[model samples]
Target: MTYDISLDKKKAILLVVGCILLVVLSFFAGLFLGAMIQQPETVTAAPNSEKPKKASAGAPAVLAKKLPAKPKVRLPVKPKVKLPAKPRVKLPVIAKKPAPTTPVATKVTSAAAPAPALPAAPKAKPEPYPYSIRLASFNQFKFVLTGLSQYRQKGMSPYFAKVNLGEKGVWWRLFTGYYPSRKAAQAAVTEHNLKGVQVIKTAYANLAGIFSSKNELNDIFKRLDSQGYSPYIIKDAENHLRLFTGAFITKKGVQDQNQDLKADGIDSKVVER
Candidate 1:
């Protein structure tokens, strides 16, 4: 017991050494096993860097490519046109003026004309006086005095007395110194175209317009004065036979008075004064 108990230090030393070697061996084996359990990884490049190749210049011959076909179209043709013909126009011609002419004269004859004559003178007759008287009238017998008065106032008086026809109721009258003699009274009555100039005398006076021959009314009175009849003259409106007594107008008045007077066997004449 004692003997082993005192075992050798050297061996102990060797055992310690062997234990360190076993630890180191275990670390190295562990490191190699961890490496062996892991696989080895291979590395590769990017896929973009590996591309396919393009066609080469030395490929097989191919045929030329043909063009596409186009659609067919036709163009239209145009027709030709003709124009109308124009007429030709002509101009008018002008005219010329003519010349002037002269005038002519003719001849005449004188034997065909007539002649002229002269004038004559006139002749004359002898002239006389123009005188007149009214003879008598047949109405207005009642106014004999009145008539006599009017005639006397006008320078005329009754040459013969007034005579009355009693049955006829009329008067006869005469103015004074109107005649020269009986011939003058007769001539005056005939000239005046009067009727019933019974007896003529230088007694009666003249009135105007009984004679157209002369202006001798006063001249006749003067002639009667020279013949010695003192007859008075008058200018009275009532000296007519109507205002006197006998009332004689025409020849018939005197004739009727004469016949009446004759029937009574009494005669009276209407003598012109």
Candidate 2:
């Protein structure tokens, strides 16, 4: 049987086929885009997988083979530059100090000189006069002066000394002459008919003179010493210096010294200590 299709029916069948083909083409294009999107993710996720299950079977074999594998990125390598070596500096060597050597002692056979002899000791000074007569003691100096003046007027050369009796206060002691013994003092008191006077044993020396200037006393002392006389000094309470010579122990010895001093033009008195 011969089928006769008109031109309009033929055109209508061609439009329907084109529409179906477009739908199928659209579906395949969607699948191909989905596969392309998932392929990189799968490769990134499991790069070592033998088979990528996510690959679409509908994908063309020629496109798969033509796709380039991920190219390995070679980072630029830094070349090692050889730097010049630093010059070695030679350190200066320090010289060590030599140790000190001990000196050797040498002995000599010659005789050694003897040491010098020491100076001889000086002679001891003689003792002072050991006896004097203390006539009376007064508490007030004026009274003692009055007594001294009265005694002087009566042909007696009297002297006074100031003595501190500590808790008893200071006293002015009146004396007439230096005596070698208490008996000699008593004899003098009796000869003078002195009353209320007692003999006291004490030390005294012959007084040459009282001088205000120590220089004058020293001059006189030197003169006496040069003349072979032993002279000494005593500072009185009045700040005056009294020069004395020869501390005699006997009345004869005192008289002899007085005579000798007189011969030498030195005036002295045997006043009380």
Candidate 3:
């Protein structure tokens, strides 16, 4: 039967077509699966890239495994800070002393400057005289004054006064009253059991001559023209003109003058003034 028997060819063609279809189906399936289950993109460093940190596989636990980085030996750098400047303080200036000008001007300026005022000192009061006791008088005798030191030792300031009775004058009357008042003097006299405490006014005298004639007194006075003796004359109660050389409290003064008059052949005596 020569009937058109193309079965082998048809089977070959079918096999070829089946193989082509399987290839196309596998390509489309792979494309669709790749698109559905896509993986995230990973960035990798180059081998020679200089990074301060080591590469990590995106894992937190990998930090300890990272190689220790090169220790950057940083040098110490000084910080630039501005400081406030110190303020200047003014000092007091002392003026120098100037040279002196004219001597008159120097004197004037010195005089112009007032002296330092001193505090007033308390004024001292005058001392009252010491109380005294009047002892008896030795009318016919001279007071030797040898007992004066003894009286002073006994707390007594002893002294003498003369009572003039013209030619009959009493002897030096011993006393000690430099006392303030008569009462004080009386008290001192009573204390010492002293009697006859008569107050005596201060007196002094000396004599060069006692002449009956004023002419004889003048002659003696004119002869005593020495610079030492001051001579003067007065008529006494006896109507006798007595010439005095000087007045003195002490008898020794008059006695000495009497000795000097004796040297000059002129006699003298002491009297109260």
TM-score of each: 0.19, 0.32, 0.25
lDDT tens readout by residue for model 2, 1-273: 134557778989999999999999999999999999999998788766667456568875554356778999999999999999999999999899888888886665576666544323224333233554566789986787688678879997666555455799876667666555677778888899988887765454567877766776777788886775656565544556667765433455456667778899888887545
**Could you give candidate 3's per-residue lDDT for residues 1-273 as a string of tens digits?**
334467777888999999999999999999998876664222333555676776577756543567889999999999988898888988899898898776663466655868644333224332333233455566753342554555667786565434454597645556564455557767766777765456443234466655667665666777775433446555544555556554334566556556666788766665554
TM-score of candidate 1 relative to the true fold: 0.19
**lDDT for 71 (candidate 2):** 97
Judge candidate 1 at residue 246 and give its lDDT. Answer: 31
Best by TM-score: 2
User: All models: lDDT?
Assistant: 0.44, 0.68, 0.58
Query: Once all C-alphas are superposed, what RMSD does model 3 give against the true structure?
Result: 28.7
Sort by lDDT, best first: 2, 3, 1
Which candidate achieves the best lDDT against the true structure? 2
Worst 10 residues of 3 by lDDT: 121-130
Question: Which pairs of residues collide in candidate 2?
Answer: none
Encode model 1's per-residue lDDT on 200-252: one tens digit a residue. Answer: 33221222112222332445445433542222333223222211123223445
Which portions of model 2 miss their true places by more than 4 Å?
Answer: 1-129, 204-273
